[model samples]
Target: MKKTNILKNGALGALVLSVTFGCASTQQEEPAAAPAAKKDTACQAELAAAEAARKKAASVGGEWRDTGKILKSAKKALAAGDVAECIKLANKARRQGEMGYAQALEQRDNDVNSYTVERGDNLWNISGKDSIYGDPYQWPLIYKANRSQIKDADLIYPGQDLSIDRAVTSAAVNAAVQHAKTRGAWALGVVEESDKAYLAR
Candidate 1:
């Protein structure tokens, strides 16, 4: 009878040990799985955000090379199980995209003038007219403004619309005036000391 009791006790202890170990194993697996799931979810969210930003930037004609590179790096980090690095790269890409969109908006807003080309209107004549910048040498401004329509600076069709961003014209004129002054055009009678005196007559 004593031998039977000893065998029963030993069997009971073995069964209890197995059950405890099984529960412990299950607990460890659950925690591990939870973290992996969380990491996956985070990576997916970051990727989605990055893609959205890239699209927004592209819509505004933003430079996508750098942003694209960063996004690709983010994807690589995610694939490598570096969730933190992935998120960092994704955020950087998003900011770059936003900055590009903002720059586009600023440029668009600064484009304040639009004009239609008329017959016999070359870029030089149009740019030198009193209503325009009044400087024949500023023809490049008109060419650049109408780059989409005017492939060559020397060619422009009548009735073609063109953008005339005054900001660019003003900057060019200022730079020219500075250069003329530096070259002593004022003393040589090539240009006037004041920009008003140098206006096309």
Candidate 2:
């Protein structure tokens, strides 16, 4: 009887000890859970920031692969003595590529001016306004096209009438004129296709 009682007391003590240790272990883990929750929140915040950055980057209208290819081909066409074909191909390239070429082309249409050279006439200043042409190197094209009126290509006087061919239609001219006026530049007349020949009015 005595031995049985002793064994029962030992077993009860062991059970009580086990319950105490279990409670202590749970208490210790509670603090660890707070840190884990904080890490999860930080990760969520980082993911949200990454998503926002991705959305912001997408808003920028960048160049497409096809645009580069088309522009290159159009340039090659021009270099190969095909200005008419090059212009057509360039227009097609800009249309096919969806990378804000319309706005650029619209700007190009509007900035046309029958500019008379003032006291200070330099290709740099003239070319600066014509971004589509990109450089003073394109001035030769304008000069060559208007050589009949220009006595000297390099020394255009103050009162020479330089007829700029902005586009090939009245509607195109109007669109260009409107676009230029919006940007505070004087809109010069555009070239139009007549029944017989190209005309400007």
Candidate 3:
């Protein structure tokens, strides 16, 4: 009877201690969170640097998707006094900006703005690819740049090498998009008059 009572008392004591420690740990973590989420002096500077890098990437037409979104969230975290979250998100945004700028630089310095035509590839679809211009309306830019290899804007053959002008100005891109949007109906295997006018420009 004594041994049984001692064992029962020990089990109860263990359960009580476990519950006590759990509560204590939660309380400690709660207080730590209050301090952890507080603002840091370097956080704003980090956000600024990230924004600058993102702008540089945009200048080179190399800004990746969702970078602005992440940077915006970092600002929200900063306003909410979530310094840790702001720093984490800011770091991620900064890396994206830096990598985007690097991608543009590499694409410019190296002749990486060329695409190999597939059997079913068309300029509209090829220009819409992420590695290319990512806009179907920019197909005229591809057709205009590859006039030597492409006789017709609407006709592209497999194994044909298409040159892409990655160093285009914002004005040129806008022009290409505008032209593609306003272009008339096309006859296959023949260059459209509208394409000739666009390429002339």
**RMSD to the native, candidate 3?**
13.0
Q: What is the C-alpha RMSD of each candidate to the true structure, in Å?
A: 12.3, 18.5, 13.0
**Prediction 1 global C-alpha lDDT:** 0.70
Error at 86, model 3, angstroms: 2.0
Q: Lowest lDDT 10-mer window, candidate 2?
A: 191-200
Evaluate residue 177 in candidate 1 and report its C-alpha lDDT on the 0 to 100 scale. Answer: 41
Off by over 4 Å in 2: 1-66, 69-96, 131-134, 168-201
Alpha-carbon RMSD, candidate 2: 18.5
Which pairs clash inside model 2? Answer: none
Tens-digit lDDT track for model 1 on 60-174? 5554579999999999998999899998999888888888878756765654477788998886687677556556666656655565666545567899988875554334555
List ranges where model 3 is wrong by over 4 Å.
1-41, 107-122, 125-137, 146-152, 155-162, 169-201
Residue-level lDDT of model 3, residues 129-189, one tens digit each, is 8788878899988988888888988888999988888888657888999998889898998
Q: Per the 3 Å backbone cut-off, how many clashing residue pairs does candidate 2 have?
A: 0
Once fitted onto the true fold, the runs of candidate 1 whose alpha carbons sit more than 4 angstroms away are 115-154, 157-161, 164-201
Query: How does model 3 score by TM-score?
Result: 0.54
TM-score (C-alpha, index-matched) for candidate 1: 0.58
User: What is residue 68's positional error in candidate 2, in angstroms?
Assistant: 2.8
